[model samples]
Target: MHSQDKLIMIYGANGYTGRLIVDHALEKGLKPIVAGRNKEQVKQIAEEKGLPARVFDLDSVEQVANNLNDIAVVIHCAGPFSATAKPMMEACIKSKTHYTDITGEIVVFELGQSYDAQAKEAGVVICPGVGFDVIPTDCLASQLKDKLPDATHLKLGFDSGSSMSPGTAKTSVEGLAQGGKIRENGKIIQVPLAFKTKTIDFGNGEKNAMTIPWGDVSTAYYSTGIPNIEVYIPISPKGAKKIKRLNAFKWLLGTKLVQNFLKKQAGKSRGPNEQQREKLKTYVWGEVRNDKGAWVTGHFETANGYELTYLGAVAVAEHLLANEIEGGAFTPSKLVDNKLVERLPGTGEIHFKPE
Candidate 1:
């Protein structure tokens, strides 16, 4: 068998985020095999980067597993992960290859967690949200839990200045169809769109954030043992109101015609250019409260979401290559550490306040 440590495979290497990860991997002096359903595009990127190439799709676990035999880690970047994560994850588990993805979808995180035992048994790690989706926020949650060990509830929010990638926009379209969610007493509870709003001071100033079904709703609970968890993203009052109004038409949004149209529109986006990625910033905040009402709040600022995704994803994959961590489904912070966010290329020091 070829040395797995030297063989990293990036599935979906032609997509917006995937290409960034590929470029970053090369910059770090690593030659990763680029693979995707689009044979021509994947091969083109591989040839341009002077790396190996493979072509495969998530049609079946057996098919994907066949392609993953010599791969040590597979960064599954293709999405909507709701449809893509399962087959790719199962393939990794079947092939006993480590699996990672930059997915922010709650179902995908939950799906990774569900395979924990199998992953451990297979001696293969399966971790999702290795990107901007939950790394910073998940790490923040872990830090807050460490600060307030008896915390009963956790709240997380993020403020980003970056625009959405096509994958992200398409994922947002899918999330809107599912409404909202939060973790309550260790159970996932579905709520209305923009179900709750709060003003959070994410370091710089006060920003209005609205509850969204972020991946941390699942990963944080597992990471912190917090019985209740809620994640929010910055939104204006007017935007929140508009989202609330969207509740009545959510069913319509789920229809085939509307979903297809929205997805097509989302596909048109090329995401941020190099300059925008360098200039934009993302801030993440977290608060933990115990029964006594004592709370600890903290926030950290980092690179733009897409830039951070590629950086975080590559960092985790490199960590997997260099170290021997336990094999199981994990949040990024769990697989790495809470300090992983701080170690990113463009992250500010974490700030915390006790109240």
Candidate 2:
């Protein structure tokens, strides 16, 4: 793809993750068009970064579709995607533009899958969960499938870096509010958030982990035909107890008052700033068990989750720009190559062992 033809649009250009993605895209020599509902913010970012900007309300599907001309792909960073992904996807399908997002919400991911036939017909790809939340897990599962060809159960655990961003916190809060699901007997089964806990030893030390709803919970089921899949994140014992306690009040999550309250809390929540991110370190370990009782595991770590997410997004964007992947709606676990995953930064540390 010529540099001029690589017109990438960042939908939530003013936000935290969006800004990182935009900066990475620019560094890669791709001139990105910063776009968002907030014209002033978008314009400011574009002007400061020396890029172009566009304003569009996500509520208007027609307007989004109309604006897709000449764009190679749209890297959507706006979230709470359960409310926004569908419309944006419809617009992309109408415009025959490739669509990718960092969303890990199972509901939104499943909704993206529902567009497979339409996207295939349009010769466009709609990929969701192309970031840290699922990419590492997805890629590890794919690798394990190669080592344990008959694997039937998959478990993933990760030690996150200290520097959590507002976007990450918001996603976590939303997932907590909605609860989580895992594959069982070849079907999606809803479960209470943080219902199960495990101790994962990644060689550094054993960290307490909780069952979290990760995109791979859905993606791995279809990609590897694994009947059971679970993703876990290491948390402090105190944090684990707090999450368990929060489960008791899950009912409140459905109430508007609670939701609004969370929104307010999320607005005030601050994550580590730029300097802290530079010092952060993240690690992930994964295990896949076969029906015959054989299992294999792998480990990976990085400077930070957000940085890894930016690298993953850039990898996905490069693939989209080159039209290297088959055109259809899919997840990273299904679409991205395991070898390529290893080559990506922070992924080289991944080590696999069979038992």
Candidate 3:
């Protein structure tokens, strides 16, 4: 399943992160067919990259499916995945094409899992969270699970001092009303933002961490079968307090007008440039504790989170195309060995130690 042999369609190929994926895919000499809802942007980008392009919307899912006729894989990159994941995945199933996306949305992962049987029946691989949100953490969960096979509880945290892209910011803004979430006893549990805070030691020292609705609440569970899961991202103490306070205005945040206003305020698609990504470093920590009260704590070091996301998404896609992946929904860690992520291109200085 080398690039030449597989024609991969990149939906939302003109957006910030999508363009990164497309540029990197081209650099790797992959045969990509770029598609998106925005015809002007999509065509301009396709022309610049000298790739074939198509424009379609999820509203006409059958039309979307038709355009995917010969494409073996589709990387759905347009998101606020809350609105995009289900429709794009349904189109993939309709087209019998393998589905992948650079999404870290909790609802997206859960939706992907709900479509597992259908995906398998359609002979398609439905995988989401092929990005910073869960790739490293999912692998960490797998690593910890291996060290503590009897592990029943999993806690994961990551700190990467990097800028967020406009697309990412919009996605977060889209979920302002829903608040934070976690997995307890395999059930999705909702909680207020920053409901839990702690000091997490991710290799160097302790940093202020707070609970977030990270995709691992779903992905890691599927990957490692950990019934209890909590994921945290670094936050300032003040920021943590602010998150909790924001919940009082959940109704205001949930309003469409507010979400749209924030989207408009976000301006346009943007991301950290190469030099910025090069300077950024990422750290991840995970702990798996069993009922016996024993636990294995581990840490992972990698390049920037977003950089790793670009590299990991493509690497996972290539691995899936070149090899045999089970037909159904899965996380990166579940589909490939934990070592696969550690071995990704540009992935440097990874150490997983049980303490």
Candidate 4:
């Protein structure tokens, strides 16, 4: 139990993933304060759960910190975090509150790391990418990190047969303009989409995978000290061709008119329904190697990514509130033990293997 009677505040509580986390909290009988920038939407969800609600923008760091008064840990579910994370974190640091968010954007990881010393000094934890974006991959990196302790390079990948949430889709649209990125020798390097391709057997079978600028590009470097990192995702041949074309026209995608049109089209749909989400499965794979050519591979199969976020984020929150974890700007892997995903509540839904 949390000793201080401090609340777990769910910022952006009305978001697709945010609402799920709220439900999970309620189901566990852990009372969390619901909050967001939308008054009506946040109030409705808060009313439904009988939880306290706060409505405010990131415009005022003072107010954000004031609102976090009784909160011990915050679950920030809003995105594209590239825009939202900075302000929220700035406020959290000032408020001296532990912060965690379901962010996959590499920019957010970089932002968090930049505040590492401040977070430690403030006696607060700043952990982002607690979602599917990297938790599972972060854990797999640890597995491979242990397997090849002197590894200098890391390759991590995941495939989940799940629908994209509106927030996830929005983030993708934002990234379309940026192309792709990878971390090399402790630096982030931009590349065109599909810069590299490989075949990965994510337990079920081998499939075509494309290098992507997943969160691990930042998190893995910090978590395992692997200086070179690349993350991949399985895509169809058609998907590959589509991405190549998008890369060619990325500049146009960056234009306000095109981005607005895409956003409007994207806003039409929400995330998956419960039936759809529960049926989805996720897979993660990682390989780490040294200059000696020695390498190790690891795999993990888990429940739906969104569901895991609810579980993973809440568990991390409990750990934070209990001071079972340390204060720092941390990736999920670094803040928690080696097998956090396996130790989580829904562990029955996960399978892990090493080779």
Evaluated at residue 37, the lDDT of candidate 1 is 95
Off by over 4 Å in 1: 1-5
RMSD of each: 1.3, 2.0, 1.9, 2.0
Stretches of candidate 3 exceeding 4 Å from the true structure: 1-5, 349-355
| Top-down lDDT ranking | 1, 4, 3, 2
lDDT string for model 1 (190-227, tens) is 99999999999887699888999999999999899999
Q: What lDDT tens digits, residue by residue, belong to model 2 across residues 148-211? A: 8888898877787675566666666777777867888777888887868899986468888888
Predicted model with the maximum lDDT: 1
- How much lDDT does candidate 1 score? 0.91
Q: Between 1 and 2, whose lDDT is larger?
A: 1
Q: lDDT of each structure?
A: 0.91, 0.80, 0.84, 0.85
The CA lDDT at 94 in model 2 is 87
**Candidate 1: how large is its RMSD?**
1.3
TM-score of each: 0.98, 0.94, 0.95, 0.95
